[model samples]
Every structure is written in structure tokens, then in C-alpha cells.
Target: LEKKIAHQDAIERNAIEGKFGEGKRKYGLGRISARLQTTSETVIALQFLVMNLEKVLRDTFLSFFQIWKALYLFVNRKKYTLIIEK
Candidate 1:
């Protein structure tokens, strides 16, 4: 049971750490140069916000693409059958 719990914790930690790593690598989280505390906080907050928004946009686009692809295949399947019958 302890090992299971440790494994689960590691999984969660890796996910959180991966997000930070992604932010640092892709979103300039590591390059903030603000000297003021408030400015630094604001920059970090904005970077996180942008990351979350990007995730949402990507998920939404993928969902839409999947739905569109399904509809297209369904329509084409019927057309294909009709053409074969003729």
C-alpha cells in the first residue's frame, strides 16, 4: 500500500513538474527580468494564465477536429455505399 501511494504521488508530482518545465521552456517562465516583487508576480501569473489558455484552446480544437472528422466519415460512408450500389 505504501508503494502504491508513493507511485501515485510520483505520478502527480511529475505531471506538475512537467507543466513548470514546459512553461520554462516554451513560455519564458525562466526569463522574467522584473526587479519589483509585484511585477515579477504579475509576470509569472500571466505566463501561467497563458499556458492554461493554450491548453484549453488546444483541447477545444482537437475536440472540434475529431467531431468534424467523424461527421465527414459518416457522410462519405453513405455516399460510398450509394456509389457502389449504382
Candidate 2:
């Protein structure tokens, strides 16, 4: 097919720039896998934590996210800080 040939041509060109490695330079598998590797993730703002609560409590929400990212966010509901990872 025209499209498949064009895609193969593009992959061959991209693989040269990708310069994978002697072992990784698998032409057919490399080209096909590269096409399949374009997966993605989506994150919804979900809601702004600040907008729902009183001004005095804004600090708490900011504190939660900072601390959560620190822990890689294991708990869905976390209250009190525990320095799980540093």
C-alpha cells in the first residue's frame, strides 16, 4: 500500500537519527515498534483544590500536594505528613 510504504520510508529515515545502537538497530521491528510507542497519558485538573474551600484553608491543600508528590502520592486520602521518601 502507498501509506505503508511511505510510513516505512519515514521510519527508516527516523531510525538513522534515532541511532539506536548496534544491537538495537533492528530495522523492521524497530520501525514497527517506534510507530506503536506513541502512547500517551491524560490528567484532568480534576478540580482546583483552592476554589472549593475557604481562604484560610488554602495552605492545607497546597501542603497536601507538595507532601503527596514527595511520597509519590500513594494514599487517596492522606491527612498528617509522613516523610515517606526524601
Candidate 3:
């Protein structure tokens, strides 16, 4: 049980760390050059917000594409069956 819990914790930690690493590398989270504390906090918050929005957009697009592909294949399958019978 202890080993299973440790493994689960490591998996969660890796995912969290990967998100932070992605933010630092892509969203400018690592380079907050603000003068005031509030300004710095605001910058960090905005970066995280942007990251979350991007994730949502990406997931939405992926779901849309999958649905579209399935529909396309379903329609095409009927057409192919008709052609094969004729």
C-alpha cells in the first residue's frame, strides 16, 4: 500500500511539475520582471490563466475533431457499402 501511494504521488507530482515547466518555457512565467509585489503576482496569475485557457481550447478542439472524424467515417462507410453491393 505504501509503495502504491508513493507511485501515485510521483505521477501527480510529475504532471504538476510538467505544467509549471511548460509555463516557464512557453508562457513567460520564469521572467517576471515587475517592480511591485502586486504587479508580479498579477503577472503570474495572468500567465496561469492563459495556460488554463489554452488547455481548455486545445481539449475542445480535440473533441470536436474526433467527433467530426467519426461522423465522416460513419457516412463514408455507408457509401462504401452501397458501392460494394452495386
Candidate 4:
């Protein structure tokens, strides 16, 4: 059980590290410009917020595409059946 928990923790840590790495590379978060500690913290928070919003948007689009594909296939199947009947 302890080993399993340790593995899970490592996976979580890796995911967080990956997110930070991505933010640093993509959003210029590697070097914060603010001198004040609070300002720097806020900057980091905003960067993560942007990242989360982007992720949510991408996921939403993917889900919408999947639903659209399913609906298209269903409609096409019905059309094909009608053609066969005629």
C-alpha cells in the first residue's frame, strides 16, 4: 500500500512539473518580471489560470467533435437506408 501511494505521488508530482515546464516554455513564465513577492505570485497564478483555461477549451472542442462525428454517422446511416428502400 505504501509503495502504491508513493508511486501515485510521484505521478502527481511529475504532472505538476510538466505543467510548470510547459508554462515556462510557452508563456514566458520561466522568468517572472515582478520585483515584489506578491506580484510574482500573482503572475504565476495567472499563468496557470491561462493554461487551465486553454486545456478546458481544447477538451471542449474534442468532445464536441466526437459528438458531431457520432451524429453525422447516425444521420448518414438513416439516409443510406432510405436510399436502399427507394
* By lDDT: ranked, best first: 1, 3, 4, 2
Sorted by TM-score (best first), the order is: 1, 4, 3, 2
User: Candidate 4: where are CA atoms >4 Å away?
Assistant: 1-9, 78-86
Higher TM-score: candidate 2 or 3? Answer: 3
Cα displacement (Å) at residue 50, model 2: 13
The model with the greater TM-score, 2 or 4, is 4
Best-performing candidate as measured by lDDT: 1
Please provide TM-scores, in order, for all candidate models, with all chains considered together: 0.76, 0.22, 0.73, 0.75
Please write out the lDDT profile of model 4 over residues 1-86, one tens digit for every residue: 99999999999999999988999999989889899999999999999899889999999999999999989988888665654453
Candidate 2 per-residue lDDT, tens place, 51-76, comes to 23444477788898898797774563
Clashing pairs in 1: none
What is the TM-score (0 to 1) of candidate 3?
A: 0.73
Model 4 residue 58 lDDT? 100
Residue 6 in model 2: shift from native, Å?
76
The residue-level lDDT of candidate 2 at 23 comes to 20
- Computed on alpha carbons, the lDDT of every model, listed in order, comes to 0.95, 0.49, 0.93, 0.92
Q: Which candidate is the best by TM-score?
A: 1
What global local distance difference test value does model 4 have? 0.92
Summarize candidate 3's per-residue lDDT along 1-86 as a digit string, tens digits: 99999999999999999999999999988898999999999999999999999999999999999999999999889665644453
